[model samples]
Target chain A: MDVSDILAAHEAKQKAIVVEKDIPLEVDAGFLTVTDLNPIDVESYNEDLEDYLLNTARDGVQTLIASLFQLPVTPSEDGPVAKLPAPTTLLPRAKPLPKPKPLTKWEQFAKTKGISHSKKDKKVWDEEKQDWVDRWGWKGANKATEVQWLTEVPKNADVDFDPSAQARKARKERMAKNEKQYQQNLARAQQAAGSASSSTPNATSNVQRKRELDKTLATTRISTASMGKFDKKLDGEKKLRGVKRKFEPAEVSSSTEKSHNLAILSKLDREPSAKKAKSGGDDVLNVRKAVRFASKGKGSAALARQSGGGKGKKGKR
Target chain B: MSTFRAFILTTTVILAMLRTIKPKNARSKRALEAREPKEVEDPRTVIFVKGTHAGEKVDHAMKELMALKRPHAISFSKKNTVRPFEDATSLEFWSQKNDASMFVLGQSTKKRPDGMTFVRMYDSRVLDMCEVGVEGWKSMQEFKTAKATPGHKPLLHFASDLFDTHPRLQQLKSLLLDFFNGEIIDSICLKGIEYVISITAGPLPDSPSTSSELPKVHIRAYTTRFLSSGTRVPRVELTPMGPSIDLTLRRHQDPDPELLKQALRRPKLKKQDIEKGLGNKKKMRNLEVDEMGDLRGRVHLAKQDLGKLQTRKMKGLKTSRDDADESDESDEDEGQVRRKRRKV
Candidate 1:
């Protein structure tokens, strides 16, 4: 080999032997390597040996002298400490561990959906949880804080946390939102009303006229079957209205006959006639009187006519 | 001697008249007719089964009622002459059988004109209308902060003394309240072996203005409470017991399986379909009847055959087939195996 190549190889050997002084890396392998090699502080030993010595020179001579006084070396009771071999210049370098990924803005926003980002800057209240949360980024600003929104709701900020009151606040906010929407709708309706009033003068009157004309047109198309029935009904009604509203003379005559019979019965109970008693001896008289009374609607005139041709039957006494 | 005899006779007549006028009118006659046919709501009925009209004991009446056959209805000439006092067994039986919602039985020393001691029963609801006793405890607020401190000992002591005065009576009242679902109860009245209890099941509270809502009931419970002192306590006022009804009750409150199933059926379905369903149920009942008829036929035949076969050992003739078959059926039903089957 050339002199320059030999010099480069020796420099590489010197660099490999040097180690950083921090928590140990590659602890699984049988080695004890340390940086800032103050030879007095750290001791390196072969793995096969039972005994080991710690280098106390780098820590200062006070530590060395204290150790030389031979203070009792009490090993740890947990597990045996193994002796590690000294690091050589030819040892390979240890690999580094992989780094963790960073969170995106969407993920950060999701976490704050139902929680307060910070307690110090309490502005907008988390309506769902009824607690204060960050307003964060609103109103054309980047990263507006909870402290700003908090000024908007002073009454809420001042009150202590009460579950029932919080629920009321949420309800009030919801109602306010609805009322705002309703007011907007009312304004729109009022605008429309103003525009319509200015534009149209007789829109409703025209609509009414159209409806009346349509009704007249509909009435002209009646079914023939229904029209015939309607005509017959009207004729029957007129006849009913024209009829005479009085009782018949036949009915009056029957009532008079009933009254006359009642009067005769009353007279029979009061006084018996001598002529009638004498007539009782005849069988023909009984049969003839029975036939006269038994006839339907038997009136005195009809009986009189049947007995003696509309004249008095008996001779005058 | 005539004057002395006359004086004695006059004295005797006056004594007899006084005895006849003894406080019989005070005892009211029990209306038995009111309790029958249609179930009465707490008709105070005093049933006097047996025992002498004079000096009739409540125990004797209770015994007679217990011994009387099931469904024995008797009418007495002296309706208010005999009475039963606090008879639990008869009270329970009458409550169950007669559907008497409330009952109270007590002995009254008041005798009738005929010198007969009588017992009286009253409608328990009368207590709700009329004040009975005093208030026991008012509200829980008094005991809310009653920690076991030196000052609290005196209050506890007072309570202990009150409990000690009537331990058994209080226990009995507690037991009765438990027996009848925990009703907002009033005092327990004991008028000569008569115990009248009044209970008002308080209304449940109204629910919030949420979609899932509950009913609201008016709390008009006029309840009285008795003190530890046996004497009637006073100063306990109450609200009106109100009408004994729930107006805003849901119709068909519970879905009766049979009724609900019938209601769910097609409205277009004819009455004949319903009749068919009922007829099927009746036919199932008739199948059991047929089985019984077969058993009776077998029993009759066995009895006839047994009589004919028994010749030498027919002196006693006690092995009746009717009795044997009945006993066999009973034993089999009771899970007792039969040894052998007699062919007869």
Candidate 2:
């Protein structure tokens, strides 16, 4: 029996099941996606763009479906079911990236002063109990001194000076201080948000973005030779808002500004000398220290030259 | 509490006064609606505030930090002469207005230099705050490397036993988690993970030290890169994405009991969410997800009698008295073997 015709048909069916390409289509089974990295065939693309795109899409889908079938399936009541892996494709998010939050009042100061936030534990190690205990709350370490068995009374204690009561009062004051601060923080946050929302909405919009882009184009236009003086103007083009250079009024003289600059210079000169004098010596009695502030601009050596040992002896005495 | 619980009456809460506000305008209505309790809460809004005095370093640190919080963060460019410790009215007012629940306050002074405070807000109220001093800082500019995309959820790595056991470090860990946790999401693409914020404890005390001192905190930010490693999972490499900071913990405030309780409250969990193993239950009946994203369900049945089972009628099935008895015996034996295999 000549079954060669049947064998050829079988081979064709098998070949169709297996995708063969110069650069095999990259199939991400996780995302059920196939990417064709191979360069486009210019001959086919130029001939018929739509037909080429359709074929390309079909091939991608075919590859993806083939990969999906390759996944291991389990028998179920309905039939066999294949499980998919986690997606690998990165999809664009719907919302814009979140903006960094504003600095809190405390954070601003900390940043400027170079303070790192330190976490405080809720519990503290108690040396007396030889164990860890709550810093505050029921049976906390803060109330330890109040519960001490032995209490010593100071010789100058008031008649009604209750040591435990005094300690409790101080602790209560600290709690009051914290409560006050918490209330204040809440108030500030509300106010900040209220004022912020008013302006934030206007900051970004289609109209504003278009206007900004137009402004950039206008600047680039005027940046050419002759500063756009000889450039051809386009119809319906808005007037350019270029920066206007300002010159000092002809009426005003440089003398007024000159004095201001001179004053600044003099202040700068005096500040260093004053600072030097303040930090001149380790002690107040040092002659160099006294000369800077106490004396009328006289050095210790100069004072000695004027009064010899008399001035020095008087200072000693 | 001691025998003398002075001012205890002042701290007591009156739950009766909790008011329900009906916003008047469409804008306000939307704002209030967004703040409504949800099974999945929105990414917390953070407001950056400057104090009476802020230095160049503070500005740079904020800029680097802000780079990570864009779109969800608001920065007050104008310097305000507000002191949080002395007065917190401004913070509360801002929280209510902006709907911001987190804050980074930067302030520098002669007494407390280079101070930063992280304030957590609950229902427009300060839940807790922790202050730290920046001993050393390195902004993103110094690294000259690519940074993580702003607003991407950060992979927070707290490499310290203190975070789990110590109370103070635990607070910082949770605070940082909320600060960097951009949005609430269930399933995420493994490749979507971008940057990591690593915090390692500086030094360990060989012996217990005085209660006054705390070990310094080192915060390092990195952009993660996945390189092919000839395996299903790729090898991860960390590139320094800066604003690396060294910090020493200072003054901290613990949330009041009533306030902390409200902060920890979560919306009711749905049955489907619980079935996904979000709750304490380790196993659930029937419906479950098997390998990858496939969902599977078990359909149970009692033992079946194979001899009486319906089969396609064929000429061979019409057993004349010849092999009917033999075929019946074979079928029974097969059924018994099947049931035994199922039991095993």
Candidate 3:
């Protein structure tokens, strides 16, 4: 290889190995290479150049004015003020049209038929008089048929007049006939009973008469005062007042009386005998009396009798 | 010998041994993978048999059972006979022939005025019968199974009678638990039904320590039915009836106790403290603190300025320079008037 070729090869190797620090420059170079520019026609190019020069000069003037006054510059030819229409005076109000009258059904039909005459005028036109007559209160040709009750009444009408009165009269007659028949049956039954009782003499007739009496008694109403005694047999006998019995007092043990005596004697320092007698003498005496009474098997009989007497007196009161 | 050299030699020998052993393991694993794609077994079949005295109730129950859509379940009617055992044996023979895992025998008798339906569910696997007498208009029973037997649990859905008034439901529940060999869990799911007993092959789902453990068998018992208006006989009606027992296997999960308790507990309403602003005017006037005082002073100054502007004459300002000031003053007056009207 030649020296220049060797030097070029070494430079190429060094460039490939070295990293590029300017990323934007490299990207711009790559973009420039990748993009293709087409040439415009001479006439269009001249027109675009002229328009760009004019717009730049105009925009520069607008921007200078905006910066000087600190206000936005109004664009020429199509500004807001130029586009808006000039204000004009308000117009006078117009008068409202008159309302038309509502037509009746007959009048509406006449109008549809292209007739000019009113319904009243047609009804008033009298041919005999040769002028419009006052048709007020005058019936039309179909006036008689207009009244719903004007039809003929048919014969043999199904309407029943005073039905309630007729029914009441029939009911009254039925009740009177029933009452007369009931009276006649009662009289016949009484006569038959009297004849049978007079003719029969057998014992069976007597039994039959007794049965008839029993049946009549069963049907008879009993008084409320006698109702209590009606079922007396079903109820048991009434209980009598219970007798009051006396109970014998239990005998007091001697050990308890001795302990009581000892307790009383211990408390007495000056006179032991008097203290013992005063404190526990009554209890010991009562115990001896209870034992004597219990041995006889009839203790407190007198007390029981006294209580019973008092109870009897209270009951009497 | 040096420790490093010995360590290197041991490691090389171990690596060489592993290299030789890995191919055999790989070959065996490949064979297992090839054989793992065999077809899974189909779910067991259910057999439904109608008893001799089965009437409209049995037909209704049969329709409800069919609606459950148990895998390959079939129904058949038997000759009228009083012996339930004979009928059961015949049903068993037919079920065995058909390869059915469970049989539901329905017998309704006229002996009970409330129209009691005697339902006996026979499990071929356990060789046991779970008999339930459904009485009254709204008697319902629900049976749920966990992952034990796929077709063993009878499917009963949309039955009209769903109330748990029948005394025999308890007996039926015990029989079912015995057949499944599962622990019972009392559930407070519905009214009148005492339990939501679960039969799980694994640990109980409700136990605190083992709650994370999944249940293999879950049986839920409850009654649910639709309501109807009018006095028409509830019988022969195609309305929703239940006392349904759902049997699910492997789908049982632990229910949140706290959430359930919160749901069951009555809600406490917060008492609203309505500030009527009765003392607001006094509070507004007595602004002693710095933050409120500054705001109050500003308000007072604004009020005084408004009063002064209201009393001042508009004709006093006549200079052209004061034209802008006059306009601003007028705008402020208008704004103050608007604010006063809004306050009023």
Candidate 4:
């Protein structure tokens, strides 16, 4: 069989089989004619259309615009349209500007004239003046160059005048003068040394003799009052008499008095005792005896009056 | 015979003793035999002369001079006899008569409120004539009753303005310092008195003919006693006088400029060489670090390439095993499994 006839038979058989099966049919088929489909009610359709336009149509348009522009859109409460955000991604963040550098005088002039500033050259040394010179700019080459001729050249005056011969002559004269002075000083020093050496021994001997004389005189010296011959002999006699008197008896009884009178006679025969008395060696007994003999009667009356009058007057009262 | 002999001996002894005895005058003559003469010392005298028109300034000056305790300071008060700044001959004669080596003459007039005091040393050699500005003079008189200690030195103060304004004052101050042997003090305790002396010079009044003559010297002296706890009232008075000789000799002589330059010049500083050594050290250190880092980087890169090659060989072996397994399965089945895996 041809392919079309075979396919038609298979379709027929499949349809028969489907008819034989109890497959339920749809309760309502889709509309077959234009009239069977209800005509759109103009009034109700118009009302729904108006409601959508009022509620959500504007928001949909805003969303469409936002999406097209790649903007983040959010719906606002009071209005149907969404708000448009600022395009932050489109513009970069602002940064602070850098500070401008201060301009120097030369730099300011150069800037006004639209010229770049150039560096100055290093200073050069001037040989004649022995100093560094700034050779550029408005100061215009140090004045050292103009005064080069005035600098002294340090000429050799010795070669021109031959001063070595004159110097040598003056030095020889000074040497001769110095030699004469040295000789004189040497002679003077030698003479002084000789004189000093000679005088030293004489002075030493004189001092030694003086010391010996002083020692000898110190032992042999006596009192100035007894330097006379007679006074010396009398002093010796008085000393002898003092020695003799010590051996006599302590009590001056008549027996001892007779012996003392004999001793005095012996002293008077040998030498005078008056010289001893004048030399501050008077006897106390003799002095008392002399005083008593001179004022005996007069002293008794005065003594009696002085002692009895005051006592007798007090007794009478 | 024995009694007769004793009487004769006693009479002879008495006669001899009386003859040998010397008088008191003869004894005194012996004492005068060996006596040395005593030395005599010359007296130092400073005389104070009160001149014409001198009111109380001379009295105040005398008090200060006494306070100084100078060796022999004598005050001569012949009010109408000697005039202030009179001829030098009279002063010379007066000084010679008084045996005074130094003289201080004081005078004050209506023209100068501050009194004048002239100090002359070595006869007529006038040292200075200065003003003594006296304030509270009456109060100082009250303090005269109070006694100072035996050797207490009075404090001396020179006002700073006196030194700055008057050149002659500096000269006078130096002279005073020398005269006092630097014993003048700058300050003192409240128990003692403080004397502030200022000296100045002005034009001479009557003698306008001799412009070369020394200027009229004026001295202002102030005296005050400080209580332990109270404000002090100082007595101030000004004195003016003229000197016989020139005062220019008191100025300090200037030194030679060339000698000063030689003395004050300083030596130049030498340059240092350590900076070059330090720079070389830094350069050597940097070179060492660079060489070390380059060597380390070469080794690290070689190891990384070796590791990458090993991983690539391992991946190649895995891909070959997968190719063998894929060759065993049907293309359609493998495709469907891959699709299922992708869907899962």
DockQ of each candidate, alpha-carbon based: 0.00, 0.01, 0.00, 0.00
For model 4, the stretches where C-alpha displacement exceeds 4 angstroms are A1-317, B1-45, B56-71, B83-86, B108-114, B131-139, B143-147, B161-165, B175-344
User: For model 3, what is the error of residue A219's alpha carbon versus the real structure, in angstroms, after optimal superposition?
Assistant: 99
What's the i-RMS of each model? 46.8, 17.6, 46.1, 57.1
- Return whichever of 1 and 2 wins on lDDT: 2
Model 3: per-residue lDDT, tens digit, A1-317?
A: 46998777766654432322221110111000000011112354246632432222222222221222222233444331111111111111011111233454446688899989834453556564466555433543223233334344447535653444444566567669878866776676666566566767656777888889755543332322443245334244332223233444466688977887888887653454654565645644455467446545445764465556555344321
* Per-residue alpha-carbon lDDT of candidate 4 for residues B250-294, written as tens digits (9 for 90 to 100): 222222344334322322211221121221233222222232333
lDDT (10s digit) by residue, model 3, range B1-344? 59789768865764564343223587877754432211211233456666666666545555554444345566665543434333344444454355454556555556422122222222221233443343212123332322222333221111101111222232333334222212112111111111121221212245578533332222222221212222111111111224233221211112134432432232222121111112113333433335333322223433355534645445455345356566688766776688799789
Model 3: lDDT of residue A190:
67
Candidate 3: misplaced stretches above 4 Å? A1-317, B1-44, B77-82, B86-88, B110-126, B137-171, B174-344
lDDT of 1 by residue, A125-184 (tens): 665557765553343121333224342444646456444455457656876987886677
lDDT of candidate 1 over B14-92, digit per residue (tens): 4554343233443422343333332112212333333233233333323332222112222233333223322233333
Candidate 2 residues lying further than 4 Å off, grouped into runs, are: A1-317, B1-28, B189-191, B207-212, B289-344
Better of 2 and 3 by lDDT: 2
DockQ category of candidate 1: incorrect
Give the docking tier of candidate 4.
incorrect
Residue-level lDDT tens digits of model 2 in A48-129: 7435544554444445555655566665665455565533333212122333456767887999999999999999998877
Q: What are the TM-scores, per candidate, against the unseen true structure?
A: 0.12, 0.43, 0.18, 0.22
Instruction: List clash counts for every candidate, in order.
Output: 9, 82, 28, 28
Worst 10 contiguous positions by lDDT, candidate 4 chain A:
A27-36
